[model samples]
Target: MTQFEALPYRHVLTVPTVPTAVRLARETTEDVLTELGVNPRHPTVGPALLILSELVTNAVRHAAAASPQTTVIYAAGEDCLAFGVHDRHPYQPSLYGAATVTEGGAGGLATVMELTLGLGGTAVVRGDADGKGKSIWITLPF
Candidate 1:
């Protein structure tokens, strides 16, 4: 019998706030999913990529503006993968409802929410480390 070592919830990554980071995030996430038997051509891939893009963009734009030294990390647990974007800004992200979703404002947040919901997942935004910054996290069930 072979023993499988249990994984921890601390697979963290800190990437720069540049265009390459965005590409790297999408590619790395796709690779992770594929390595876990998730087909890249699956319908869910589109929305997943879109969510990743929006979150990363926000990090590079808003978060980076407030805190230039931010890094996005991914922590994988037993049944889910959490995508976290941590910035140095000491503020929380707000979620928009259906009205904003249709109003064409707050599009990135809305898109992330919609994609996460459609994929049977949830999106979370909270202040990081004593509320010195924010981390926008989305948990996707595997």
Candidate 2:
């Protein structure tokens, strides 16, 4: 394994649920991926960033009322990159089922599932201990 792959890295950013959060999250994710020694030009990284942007956009759009703020997370190790978007809304949607949750097979969550699975990655949701929130995490190996 490369030196970077042998080391663990992580970052988290919590921001107000607003339209600007999408851009902020995407930019920060790219920066964080660089810090984790991930190649920006990598094919999987592009789709991964797109997936993360969609997740943050979804939170800002749908959970803004109950979740005034959303968190973007990044963690990497063992030659894999992992990240997630967390909101204070209690509903934890399944990424697999999200494919059919939207009309015409087009939605943030649906697209996330498609890209993640298509890349041989994994996506799952983890509920907060207090049960008032959840985090949707995606892990992709580069």
Best by TM-score: 2
Consecutive 10-residue window with the lowest summed lDDT within model 1: 1-10
- Among the numbered candidates, top lDDT falls to 2
Candidate 1 TM-score, true structure as reference: 0.77
Q: What overall lDDT goes with each candidate model?
A: 0.69, 0.85
Task: Look at candidate 2 and tell me the lDDT of residue 109.
Answer: 86
Query: Where's the lowest-lDDT run of ten residues in candidate 2?
Result: 1-10
Show the colliding residue pairs in model 1: 89-133
* lDDT agreement of model 1 with the native: 0.69
Model 2: what TM-score?
0.89
User: What does candidate 2's lDDT look like per residue over 11-110, in tens digits?
Assistant: 8899999999999999898888777667789888899889998999999988999999999878788568888799999998877888664656578888
